[model samples]
Target: MTDSRDVVRRLREGFAWRDTPVGVFADLSGWWRDPELLRMLGPSLAGLHADASPTVVAGIETRGLVLGPLAALPLGVGFVEVRKEYRVAGEGQRDGADPMLRAGTPPGYQDGGLTLIAPRRLFRPGDRVLLVDEWIETGAQASAVRRMVDEAGADWAGVAVIVAACPPEVGERLGVKALVTDDQLPG
Candidate 1:
């Protein structure tokens, strides 16, 4: 049987890990430049959908955009974008105004470079959300998204990442399931 751990390992190996710079920003952004990275992660992410229980997916903006929808589709659930642009969190702000305005990444994320939004649009009061992202090295983005989910009054079902550089211990603190490890990436 195919296990999640194996799947994670496979996804990690899909990327050209050797090409990434040692720093956090460079490492994260560098993954985007490698086409093979996505090719590898895409299938592994699909595997996540196949194995997961039914649930709505909350994708982190920009990066998580693709990962979120792909996973949710297999589960027959709707996908929502958790934006990094900031908008006021209250009524009378013009519904459907600018979704991106309020959906920013969080402060202190990736060394405090990213700021997440205060409002979450794709959730109901009691909705269950499974947060998915491209990778989780520091958990900054994941934590930021979690805060947004909580602010939206949605229940966080779980967290899934395509690659996890830190071990399970680090992931556990941020409610992350490192479906794959950094070492799994191609050298």
Candidate 2:
């Protein structure tokens, strides 16, 4: 079993903490380079879906880009990237992604969410998908993507996150499972 507290410890050690105008933020660039963390978290997150047997794993842009692939590998499933506006070349649909998440730009993270445009064909009827993200704050992104999945006629197995700060109602409504919670963050 993945000790959820261990994952919290890894996150506290690997991520740099800060307070912004919006709220507390943790920079995850260093977390990506920490092999110990990658090793610890991948299977932990994938384990969240071990029983459901998801056919595809979908992740949001930026943070999810890394964690999603890692989780998918353990599950032995294909990975799909849910990207920011126009990030993916060729044909894709808009799912109203977070306008605050501008990669390689100042203030790279956003607390307030936006509608993201994702690929039109990420799923098919009866496709079981597990949505992955590094964190779940307001649950807006996950909720929006869940709507997309429903519209696509795909089964939303559930949402998995490394850490979550959303309220209990959000998690219940979105069917989210996380390794750690906002209250678990170490000082």
Candidate 3:
């Protein structure tokens, strides 16, 4: 087993900050490229909530899509995707034929709200779901996901993330577990 500290150190080593026209953005490409880091990520995050014995892992679209399965595979649970409602050029917001559970997020660090949707059938009543994501900056999306879980009558097992950059209160409220805190990142 890899030491938790070692995993965190490796993650930090792989993380970088890139400046774009908009502003500084976190570049986590290094984390995805490192083979050892990839192997460790799932188990490390899942270990945090092993006691919870989550029945399923739910990942938000984008980065969460990658991390969710990694965590779920070790936990012996299935994975579910929570996608953002997207608008195509010709069509408006896209909605599939399958019934979806949707929730609107509060304004987050990005200063924009999004609608998170997932197939209603994926979640069942009494299921314990653990959400896995790369980062939690405002807990807005996480909060929305929690609401969706509630709508499905499933229990929230809590959240596991690579980094916890949200406020202390938010972290406490959401039951967040993380490999590293914001302050631990390179300046």
Best by TM-score: 3
**Model 3 lDDT tens row, 1-187:** 7589889889889999999999998999999999999999999999989899999999998999999999999999999999887632243435665678998887653577888889898999999999999999889999999999999999999999999999999998999999999789897
Which TM-score value belongs to model 1? 0.66
List the candidates' TM-scores in order: 0.66, 0.79, 0.92
lDDT value for model 3 = 0.91
lDDT of 3 at 106: 71
Candidate 1 vs candidate 3: the TM-score winner is 3
Candidate 2 at residue 124, lDDT?
68
Clash count list over all predictions: 26, 9, 0
For 1-187, candidate 2 gives per-residue lDDT tens digits of 6676777788877767788998887877677887877887778999977788888888988888888888998898888777665455465335783322222212323644344555556666798889889888777777667777777788998888988888889888877888877677665
lDDT of 3 at 163: 95
After TM-score superposition, the amount by which residue 70's alpha carbon in candidate 1 deviates from its true location, in angstroms, is 0.7
- Residue 180 lDDT in model 2? 77
Question: Ten-residue segment with the worst summed lDDT in candidate 3?
Answer: 86-95
List residue ranges in candidate 3 displaced over 4 A: 87-96, 107-109
